[model samples]
Target: MGDLKILICVLIFSIKTVHSTKSKPHIVIIIADDLGWNDVGFHGSNQIPTPNMDALAYNGVILNRFYTLPQCTPSRAALLTGQYPMRYGYQGIPILAGENRFLPFQIPTLAKKLKELGYDTHLIGKWHLGQGYRNATPGAHGFDNHFGYWNGFMGYFNHEATGGNMVGLDMHHNDEPVWDTRGQYATDLITEKSEEVIKGHNESKPLFLIVSHLAVHTGKGGVDLEVKDIAENNKKFGYIQDERRRMYAGMTDELDKSVGDTIKALAEKRILDNTIIVFFSDNGAPTIGSALLDNTGSNWPLRGQKFTVFDGGVRTVAMIYSEQLQNKGTINNELIHITDLMPTLYYAAGGDVASLGKIDGINQWLTITKSEKSQRSEALINIDEARNVSALLTDGGRYKLINGSTVFSEVDGDFYGETGRDDSNPEYNTDDILHSSVNILLRGNLTQEKILNLRKQMELKSCRKSTIDHDSCRYNSVCLFDLFEDPCETTNIANKFPEVTERMKSKLEKYWSEVKVQRKGFLDPNANPVYYNNTWYPWLEDTRCHVGDLRTILLS
Candidate 1:
């Protein structure tokens, strides 16, 4: 009887151990809002110290060429669904009465997919994908525990500026709007919450945490630098002329400290070995207000700001730090985007995400885990209708196409107005005449003939919206440049290679057509954000890129 009892006890213990071992690895995704590719220490910024982010890069797989959508909501939508933003009809940041349109309710997000796999998913900080307005719900999507604001920007100190401010609406902790407060700074507060979630997770099951930080996004006016140490070092920090960058740097400093805290917590909990942590930015920086923000930290040499389709707009800082990962100090330049996150995390956590349909991103697991290069090259297409500009990158390496040079030359603001073309002498590269001509045309100083010729050349062989669409004239002039050859995008080889231009245009149009099918149909059918045919406009009143307003928000 004693021997039989021992055998049963041993058998039960073995079963429990096996079950625990089968549990998935803990996964955490930390997304920084509106951070430039050069903002963090890993990217070689000396103005602000980012020890935590730099540590991740040194110890893990640093993806130097990770790509994301040009803006926040679209990027979030893509990240959550593992699909291109357009596929779900959320190509633009849909807005109605200051409230933006969100990702469609029907799409299965990463939260939902992970939840289906029996992992507890939690989102801490910034939830901008969709607002919870009775019909459109944040909790309804997939996150088991959600705590954050619904809007894109908010005041770090003055909660009144952004509706209810810190205490936002549509927040849920298992279907309850629980007010969770922290006395520390906002960046620290966010990181603190992430640690709590990590430590409180069930030991028997794997965990998935989306630690979305609002640190880098703009707030009130100047930077929100109220930290004790930051104020003392005001002189040294004063080099950053804009109070916004100083405050932003303060926030970033705290954010780095918080990362260290989280790492410490993970170590204390003895789960560091099994957990995978990823850090990435939503988009590029806004080059206004704080010169320190733009001058020292932002992606320089890359033309165009946040809203434009240039490299500065969508190329982001991405790193995956995990002791379990085999790759370290390896840079994977193959094309990868925000949409790939869902499927990549799903696969990493031992779930079968192959069953998920039509994810635009390729699985970067091998590249990240084994330090192997990408098997299939991937490309990214970015569009800014208001700017009348479009760009396509062949994977994340070399070769880019910039379309609609005429509009860029004539009308678009300084953002992408300079096309390296001398409008005065079309055949010459003289900044005095040709470049000056472009400036004149943009300033409304050019003659009718000059404008007509510019329009004609810009429309050649490019895709058009429609015969009546006034913007169609701005549709399809292409400029090709090898990024490795010219990271500044100075030289245009399109004129020399007609065949390459045609091939790229065809490919670009095909991609656009496929994504267009994801549109919400037409605008304003029943007066909701999502109108007829699935078109959802932006939440901000005007979709126009306003650097001033953005700076004000960042400061707040």
Candidate 2:
């Protein structure tokens, strides 16, 4: 009788262990706005110290070949839906203030899908996909709670967008404007709210938190593009002589602190070991003098800056940190797109990827964690409607085909609209610094020679060289470059590789045709009238200005 009782007790213990191991892991995605490729310390930036971010990179896997749209709206839209932005007519153009454009409620977002699987969804920070529309709000998109601004950017201290014809308050908590948060800095407020959410998370179910930070981007209503950092923080960068660069560095420091705070909160809650954290920039940095008052962000060692289809404009900083990673402190050079995160995270939460229909994204969790080669070998397409440019990269980023009129241009002192700054040029080569830093961070697990060899393996030989004329290359024109041999895109080789060029052009044509069909059925924001407070008004109209005024029109 005693032996039989002991056998029953052992059987019960084994069953409980198996159930505990099957619990779903928490997901946390942290995104930075307009963060440059060379901005973080892990990427070999001595100007800005990102110790916390550096630690995470060393403890996880770095995605070396991550790609995104050239702008914010398209990137965010693709990330949430796991589909190409062009499918929904959200190309590369940004959604401006007072515009009727927004993510439609009919579309299913990653948040909505995860919430159905019993996860708490929360968003803390910038939500630039939509504003002023009731159905386009974050709560309507499957987020249980949201605390941030709706527009692209606003004053860091005042929380107001006072640029061009866009002058109004933009901060919000859920659906209502948050007026009491006027004096606080936007970055700190986002951090505080994120900590609160992490601490108050329910233990019974997993959590899905998206912390989209508005840092390293210029503030509105300032003569010289301002970055709102505390006065004491400015003193920390006295060694940097350039005032603008110093201010930018201060902003980056605050962002790094926020990352550390979030990780610390997870640890305090005792859920750090069961959480998967992802960090990436929304798009490449805008270094040209066109927008945001001459942004001083850098995309070093690459050609072109933001607002272009060059490699520097689309390739960005990305990484994944988790205790579940099989090969930590390694670099995976697979070609992964921004849209892949949805399917990847969904699969991580024990959801079936095959059940998702018509998604452009693929599940890359296994490839990233195990350092396995990517199953996708076809070319990846990047389109920018605002610039009339398109590019196709084949042979795993070894070759590039550009179809546009824009030429490769480097950013210098004139780009920043400022003089007397030594670090004004945005194309400094930091390969040696990056290799040394990676070796040290990984405790010599990755040798310097191995890093150099990995880069060399990505290069290819050029067959011929041709001079590329800015006017000669238009929307239909084709230009080819062996990216491995000419990373700067100095020579065009379309004449030598006619077969390859024609094949890539045919692929682009087919893709464009398909997207046009998909876009035709999409809702037109300009045609439909928006209903607000029991009144119908033109979609492009800014009704917030006439709120509580006699000029208001009642539809009833």
Candidate 3:
């Protein structure tokens, strides 16, 4: 009788443990570096075939109005820390190698918060937040395991920055320089490591994996490093004419394949259905005429590109895939910000939101899963500190106001270099493609017509437009646009509605002041020890590099 009772107790305990493990969803966040709004196939890109990304979106919910910061460092910083980057002194700037600027360890990151809830956190690419200082790397920031480069960008093949102020091998595996990964393309290497992590993940605990790809971002070798072989891959991308654009297409294709492989790994591990995958670009594409590396990523139909506060720079491509999502093969046109991810994922993992302390991110699990409308009806602010430009999108991305100017104006052309929008193409069937893809993925559980009806039932809610001209808005004047009516910021109506303009302007000013005060007086990057030492890797004290000597630093 004693032995029988013990056996029954053990069985019951095992069952409860399995149930607990299954209840916690695994989180996979795959971020693309500098991927344009039109870079992927799902976004109506005729040049690049991003089938994997398309498939994921098809089988999940597309965040139609997702917004990010104007630059990589700020966007990433906000995504992880759940605060506006400006609040932390990131301020819409890339963390240049050797700079002491980094996401401070004191701040609670998404990884840290999730890890506290018994999840295994792993960051498997681009940790550009900071590098020179100790505890500035991903490992120091609550990630249990991290593999990839610490700098913003590196040569895809050589794993080194080519001709930058911090040119050196930037690849690392858990804070240590990984020299053996030289000659391996960064995308492939990251995918391989990510699969290993997935396959080897302990199923008893939930997993939080961040596969941040460096693809689509211009490598250290510039346009040449954008793709493996421009000449060879250009043949595959015969549809794309321009050499640089063709290279961009090739790189995007590789990124798509990487996404597909990641999903496959998750499915093989039997964790796909229990995992929530969030995919998005850090920011908009860096098109030609922009000061940043012009990879020729087209943010067409939208004005401006990287470094600007325009929708083209701040608005981005984003999607969330999970079996738990109530709306699959559908677009959630809510105004979702990057900061929301931390709280959303934390809540989905059953973590107490109140315990996260003061964070800018809000729990959008219900909004994301279609259980309820988005609670975020307030203005979403985007600031470019370097340019002193700020944009505000309010009322769920319908009304837009900008307090600064944009460098690039809207361009009219097809991917084949044909001038003007192709009227024949008309409206791209994003819904149809997503529905079909999801139907296939779900094994025809949802018919095309059923999916169409579902979309209609959740018809995209309309928002009012506020338009303003770029030229007139350049010198601190407010530019207003009705983003819903004009997805392209073609017209500005700031003069039409004086009261609305004043209201938004006042709000923008108040928000900016609040953010400025949160800088904590750590505003100057030049004051860092690395800037004085003139070394990208301040931890490498033995390296022969000196202050005020750019030539020696580059050579070394």
RMSD of each: 16.7, 9.1, 8.2
Q: Which of 1 and 2 is ahead in TM-score?
A: 2
Deviation in Å, model 2, residue 250 alpha carbon: 1.1
Q: Estimate each model's TM-score.
A: 0.72, 0.80, 0.83
Q: Please list the C-alpha lDDT of all candidates, in the order they appear.
A: 0.57, 0.68, 0.71
RMSD (CA, Å), candidate 2 to true, equals 9.1
lDDT: which candidate is best? 3
Task: Please report the TM-score between candidate 3 and the true structure.
Answer: 0.83
Q: List the residue pairs that clash in candidate 2.
A: 459-484
If candidate 3 were superposed on the true structure by all CA atoms, what would the RMSD be?
A: 8.2
Q: Kindly report which residue stretches of model 1 are placed more than 4 angstroms away from their true locations once superposed.
A: 1-22, 94-100, 132-135, 160-184, 221-230, 233-236, 239-242, 289-297, 384-388, 404-477, 517-556
Instruction: Give a tens-digit lDDT track for model 3, residues 1-556.
Output: 5574355334433432233434899999999988887665555444565656766766678888888887888889889988887676666557666555678778999999999999999999898887655578887888999988887788889877533433567677774667787888888999999999999999988999999999889886544545776668967866555767777778887898788778767765767668899999998888764357677787655666776666677778898988788777788888889999999999999999999888878889999897478877754556655456778877777888987755334321111121212452233344444333222333324444644454344322222124434365564667788777866676778889788788888878777876652232222333223433422343433333334654355446
lDDT of 2 by residue, 1-556 (tens): 5564355334333332111557888999999988877676555445676766765665678888888777787788989998877777777567765566788778889999899889999999888887546668788899999998776777788777542443666677886667788888878899999999999998799999999988867776533345555476557777666667778778877888788778767765667667889999987777665553445776665555565566556678888987679988777888888888999999999888887788888899899888887765544455654455677777777777878723233332111112211463332223433333222222224444544443344222232234434343455567887766776566678899999889878877666765532222223333221233212222343544223532334433
